[model samples]
Target: MKEIYSNTQRAILWLGDYSDTAVPSHPNAVLSRGEVKAAFGIAEDLAADRHHDTPEDREIAEGYRALDALLKVPWWQRIWTVQEALLPKHAVLRYGDTEMPFARFWKAFDHYFAQSYRECCGEYWLDFTDTSSNVISCLQTAIDYRRLLSHDQGLVFSVLISTFRGRLATDPRDKIFGLSGLAGTLVADYSLQPKDVFMRAIRTTITDSGSLAPLLRTPEPDRAKDLPTWAPDCCAKLGPEAQHSWDMVWFGLFAAFDAAMGTKAAMLNPSAGPVLPLQGLLVDEIYEVVVHGICRDRDEFCAMARRWQHTTETVAKRNHGVYPRGGTYKDAFWRTMVGDMILHEFDAQGTGQSRRAKASDEANCRMLWNPNGDHSMGVPFSRDRQFFTTRAGLIGIGNPGPKVGDAIYVLLGGRVPFILRPTPKKQDGATLLEYVSPAYVHGIMDGEVMKEKREPSWVHLI
Candidate 1:
C-alpha cells in the first residue's frame, strides 16, 4: 500500500506528466480565449435547450461533438488519475492527439467560469446567455475538488478525503491510502489491516497534532457497527452535512482551548489499539430533531420556508424575543440552512423580475446583520441539510440520524462537540454509559460551550 501510494513501481505515464514534445508550441495547443469561446460555441449549439438556426452553427456543432464526447468520458472521475496527476512536479493534460499545459488548462478553465459569471451578471452583455454553461460548470466543479491541494498543502490527508470521496476507486481501502503522500506527517503504515488503516490514520492525526478538527470532516458512523463515531470511514461518500467540514478553520475552532491551556495530550495505548480516551465537557442533550421537508420545486420550497419561519418565530416568542426588532435570528436560521452562501442585499431583495429572481431569493429574502461594510460573506452554517436545536436552544448542523437521547460533548482538543448517544450496558452488575457517534453540533463548534466553566469528564469509547 505504501509503495502504491509512493508511485515507485508504476511506469505507466499519467495524464499530467506528459513530455514537452507532446505539448508543442502550435497555435492549436495554446489555450487562448478565442479558442475557448469557439469550443463553447460548439458546445452551445449541440445542447438541446436551444435551437440552432444557421448552417454555420450546424457545421460548427458537428466539428465539436468529438470534444463533447471527450469531456463526457469518466477520465476526470477516476481517483488514481487525481493522485498521479497532482503528485508530479510538472504535469500537462492531453486530449486525444492534442496536448496543453495543466497550468494553462486551469487558467483557461477559471477564465471560462469568470466569463460566464460576468455574462450572467450582465457585465459583458445585458442579454448574454451561456448554452454550454453546464459543461463548463461540471469541469470547474471537478477542478474545485483539487483546490485544497494548492491552498493548504499541510492538511493533505483531510483535503484528499474530503475532495475525492465522490470519485471512483477499485478498492474501498484505496480511498484512504491513495493520497497518503499529501497528508504531510499523516502517513498510513501498509502493515495495518485495511479497516484499521483509516482509524489509525485519523488516530495518528489526532495524536500527532492534538486537535480534533479532522474528526469533524469524517463520514457518519455506522449505527450497527462498533467503529468510533469520531473516526471517518474514508471508503464512504461524505453527505451534504459533512461536506462543508473541510472549509472550516482549525485554529478558530480550537482558539479557546489553546488560549486557556496548551495542547492536550492523547491517551493512546499502543499495545491495546481500539480504546483511545479523550477528556471533554458534556455540553447538552438533543431534545428536538427538525428535518427540513424535501423541497423539489418552487412552491414546495416556499411553503417549507414559511413553515421554517413560523417555527423560528414560535421558538423566539417562547424565549421572549431574544432577537432584536430586525428578526436577525430568523435571518440566521435561513443563512444556516443555506450554509456558506455569499449574498448581496439587493440580490436578496427581489428585482421584481420573476424570471430573473434567484432560487435563494425565492426561498428566503432575509439578510444576516453585518456590522461590517462588506455585503458578501460566507455564512458558517453547515448548509444544504437539516439541523437540530439542543435543549439549551443552541442551533447545530450535524448528522441527521441522531435522535432525542443523544448527548453533545465538547472534547478538550476537539474543534466541534460530538453527538454521543448514551447506551445502557449492564456490565458486572453496574450500568455503564457508553457514548456513540462523535457528531458536529453547529453553534458550539467553536468551543463556546467550553467557556461556560463546566467540568470536563472522560468518556470511554468501546
Candidate 2:
C-alpha cells in the first residue's frame, strides 16, 4: 500500500455522488491550490483570532455548509482513508457536479473555521464537535495527519492510535493495521485477535520509544480483560459509558513531560505478557483528591478553574504556606492546569512569533488562560484529570486519580511519575502493586527524586 501510493501521481477520490462541496467552483477552481498551507484552523492551531472574521458569519456559512456536506459522505469516516488520502500527492474529492482538490476543500473549511472560530466553536464547540464521536469529529483524524505527514513529522505508533481511535473500520483489528502504513510499526496480521494486535502495537510503541508512558495514556487498563496492567488499550473509544475521546485528550502525552528524566525503559518481560518490575522509588502518597467534571462552556470553565485555584491554595498553605519549590500557590496552580506546556508562538502584542524550543515565560501561559485572548498558542488542558495533593503537600494532576494513599513513583523507563496501588500479595521481596495511572506532579517532574542518593526499591506490578 505504501509503495502503491508512493508511485501514484494523483488519486481521484470518489466521495460518493451526493457530496455537496465535492466540486467547489470546478475542477479548475482549486481555490488557493499552492496558497493553502496545510490545515490552518483553530481545531489544532487555535488561530490567533483577537478580532475574529472581518466578514459576517453568514458570508462564511457556505463554507461550513460545504464542509458539513463533504463530511456527510462516507469516505471521510473510514479508518483506511487515513492512508488513502494522506499518502497521495494529489488527491481529488469528486462528487455530483463537485470536483475539488482535497487539500483545498479541507483547508478552506479549516481556514474559514479559524477565521470565525469565536463565532463557531468559541462558545460550545457545538458545530464541529471535534471531541464528539461523530462524522465531523472523525474527519479531524485525517486533517491532523495530513498536516503532520505533509511537514514530514514522525508518526509514532501509540500517538497514531491515540489520534485515530475515534475512526471507523470494518474489522476491529484494522485500527492498528490501517495506521501501520503511515509509519512502518505494525504489520498486517489477521490471525492476531484484536487483543493481540493491540498488545503488539503497545509492545512496538514501547520498543520504539523505549518508554512505558503510553500505558499511562491508556484510558483505564484495569477495565481490559486479557491485557496486562502495563498494556495500553489501543482500542478504547467513546462508547456508551464514555462521553469524551481519551485519545485526543492524552495525545499530547507523547511529547509533554519528563517524569523519568529521559530514562529509557529498563524493563524485563519475563513472560509473553508484560509484568512491571517493582524497582522504583516510592515518591509520595496521594492525599486530597478531586475528580472534576467536564467544562462545557467558557463561563463553566472559568468558574471551575477558580474553584480549583481556591482548593489548591488551601492545600499549598497547609503543606507549608508556600510551594515547596519557592513559588506562591497562585503561581503554580495555573501552570499545573496546562501541564506547563507553552505554545511559543504568540507574543505580548498577540502577533505570531516563531520559536523552536519550549518557552518558560509565565506571561505566555497567562495569555493562554485568557478567554478573549489569542489561543494560537498551545494551552493544553483536560477537564478529565484530577486535581490532587500528596501526603507531603505536593500538588499534581493525574488521570483515574489514585485513592488517598495510593503510591506515586518515578518508575524505570517511565517519562512521567506513575500512580500505583498496593496489594496484599508480595513479589521478589517487594510489595505487590497495581498500575493505576501516570501523573504530572509539580516540582518533582524534573527527576528530583532520582537525583537523591538512596537504595533502589522494586515494585511488583501485575
**Which candidate should be chosen as best, given TM-score against the real structure?**
2
Runs of candidate 2 exceeding 4 Å displacement: 19-63, 116-155, 216-222, 234-249, 274-280, 343-382, 425-432, 453-461
Clashing pairs in 1: 16-91, 16-92, 396-442, 419-439
Candidate 2 lDDT at 115 equals: 40
After aligning candidate 2 to the native by TM-score, how far in Å is the CA of 113 from where it should be? 5.4
CA shift at 70, candidate 1, in angstroms?
2.9
lDDT of 1 by residue, 171-276 (tens): 7667676666555465646677666776777677666666654554533433326555555566654344223333332212332223213335355463345555
Model 2 whole-model lDDT (C-alpha atoms): 0.59
Q: What is the Cα-based TM-score of model 1? A: 0.64
Candidate 1 regions with alpha-carbon error over 4 angstroms: 1-68, 71-74, 113-155, 218-226, 237-267, 270-272, 323-335, 338-384, 425-446
Cα lDDT computed for each candidate against the true fold = 0.48, 0.59
Model 1 Cα displacement at 279 (Å)?
2.6
Error of 2 at 202 (Å): 0.6
Assess the local accuracy of residue 80 in candidate 2 as a C-alpha lDDT between 0 and 100: 83
Clash pairs for candidate 2: 22-98, 23-98, 23-99, 259-415, 278-458, 278-459, 279-458, 279-459
